[model samples]
Each structure stands twice: as structure tokens, then as C-alpha cells.
Target: MTTHYLTKLLRYRAWADQLTYGAVAALPEGAAEATRATIFGNMLGTLSHTYVVDDIFQAHLQGRSHGYTSRKMPEPLALNELWLRQQAMNDWYLAYAQALSPAQAAEEVSFQFIGGGDGRMSREEMILHVVNHATYHRGFVAEMFYQVPAKPPATDLPVFLRDVSQP
Candidate 1:
């Protein structure tokens, strides 16, 4: 993809992430930590997992080890802490995308996956994977919100285009 296409996608990713985290943070005490049967176990677990994956892919893009044995976070961060970390990662992605030339964006990076396999993907592919992966988990968070009996913010791409996109 062109830099503009990928930058727009990443920007939307950040916008939607902020909306998701804000909604969760606004919930009553014990809401995020509530018991649940979802993957990662609950809202907090799922959110932390997403950040951990971002860190993994960040390391991959840098050609370094992520130093994690598994995708699961050893301990979940507090909601505010997770929000800060995710925001920082989101900003990093935006800058990374903005700095890439089209040729550079297509350059391939080779790295090992956390689960013990060698892997390679173009810069564009890696970034797309991050965006898609987080979008999937954000859906998880949205479902968890339903369990909490709260309405989640609409984070769909069309919504981003309508509300947060640059003309």
C-alpha cells in the first residue's frame, strides 16, 4: 500500500483505540476486572494482550527479539496504565507510517514469531497485520461491554472516516 493509505488506516486504528479505551475507563469500578469467559479472561486481559502484540510487532519491525515467551501478559495493567501504553504505541505507529516512503514501506523484514517460527513480511504487511489484529480484539472488548450492559463506541472504519478522517 502507499504511505497515504497505510497512514490513514493507522490513524483510524488509533482513533478507534482511544474511543474503546475511553469507554472502558468510564465504566464503574470493578467493571473492567469483572469475571468473564472470554479469551484473555476479561476486558483488561484482552486489552493488555493487544498492547503486548503491538510490542511484539514493533520488535519484529526493528529486527529484534520481543523477549516474550507467550502472547499472554504475566499481569494485566490497570486500565489507565494500559490506556497510556496503548496511546504511546499508537503514536509511535503514526510516526512510523508517516516517515515511510513507498519503497521503504514495501521493504521486507524477517523475524521470529513468539511461538517459535521464523517469519517474514513487508513493512506494509506487518502494519496491516497490526491494524487487523487490534481491530479483531477491539471487537472482543466491545462484546465484553455488552456483558457489562453498556454500549460500546462505534469503531468501524466508516465511522472513523465520517468522524475522525482528514478530508
Candidate 2:
């Protein structure tokens, strides 16, 4: 990946992560249970799905089988702990991505997906998928927050551009 593209993606990921973490922290203890029923089955579900998928891909990158049969949803009692775990994993991914060379990014990585034997993708493609996947789910979570009085944080690409364009 070009340095410019990587930088833009990194910034977008950071912003999206911040918004997701903020929304998760703002929920009341009981709200976690109501989350799924209200606003598209709860931000927690979306966040959990995001984390699980990322873990799957990360393990693939590291040449390990992703043992998960299904995406795990965060328990209401352990939502905070799950959020913190996801944050740490995301931080690790960002650091790994930033350190990758352009040549490394273009190189193909081989791995297996559930129900499949082997698969391959360029490192650049994997990084793009991770960012795109997170953005897609983050939008879902953001919509869940729409009915609440507090304005949802902007997760739009143009909004990200505007922030980056600022001096």
C-alpha cells in the first residue's frame, strides 16, 4: 500500500474506533440488554461481531486456525472487558500495519477460512478489508445511537477527509 493510503486508512480506523468506544461507554448497565432490541439489536452485538471477524483474520495472518464456529456476542456483564480487549487488538493491528513495507503489503499471504482448506490475499487487500469491515459495522452501531438524544459521531469518509484536511 502506498504510504498516503495507509495513513488515511489508519486515521479513519482511529476515528471509527473512538466513536465505537464512546458509544459503548455511554450505555447504561441495563441498556446493554435492551441494546439488541433497540436500534438494530444493540451496538454490543455489532461490536462483538467486528471483534470476532478481526480475530479470525488476524489469526489467519499469523498462520493459525480460527477455532471459532460462530461470532461471539459480548455478555452484558462483561461488555467493558470485551471492549477493552477489542481495543488492544485494534492497537496491535494498527502498529503492525504501520510497520509494513510496501513490498510486504503487496505480497500474498496464504491462510484457511472456516469450511475451507486454503486461501490467499495480498497483505494490502487484507488491510483494506479490515478497515472496510470495521467501517461497515461501525455505521450499523452508529445508527443504533441515532434515536438517542445525543448526536451520533460522524463515521463518513468525507468527514474523515475534512478532519485530515484541517491544518
lDDT of 2 by residue, 1-167 (tens): 68568657866787778767776677655454354544336777777777887888888667687788765643433577777877787776778777788888888898766665778998778878888988988877766666453456777888878875332
lDDT by residue for model 1 (59-140), tens: 9887787888889887778999989999999999889988988888899999887877888899999999999999999999
- Model 2 ranges off by over 4 Å: 35-40, 73-77, 115-118, 147-150, 164-167
Query: Which model scores highest in lDDT?
Result: 1
TM-score of 2: 0.81
Which residue pairs of candidate 2 clash?
A: 35-42, 36-41, 36-42
Model 1 clashes, total count:
0
Q: What CA RMSD would you report for each candidate?
A: 0.9, 3.0
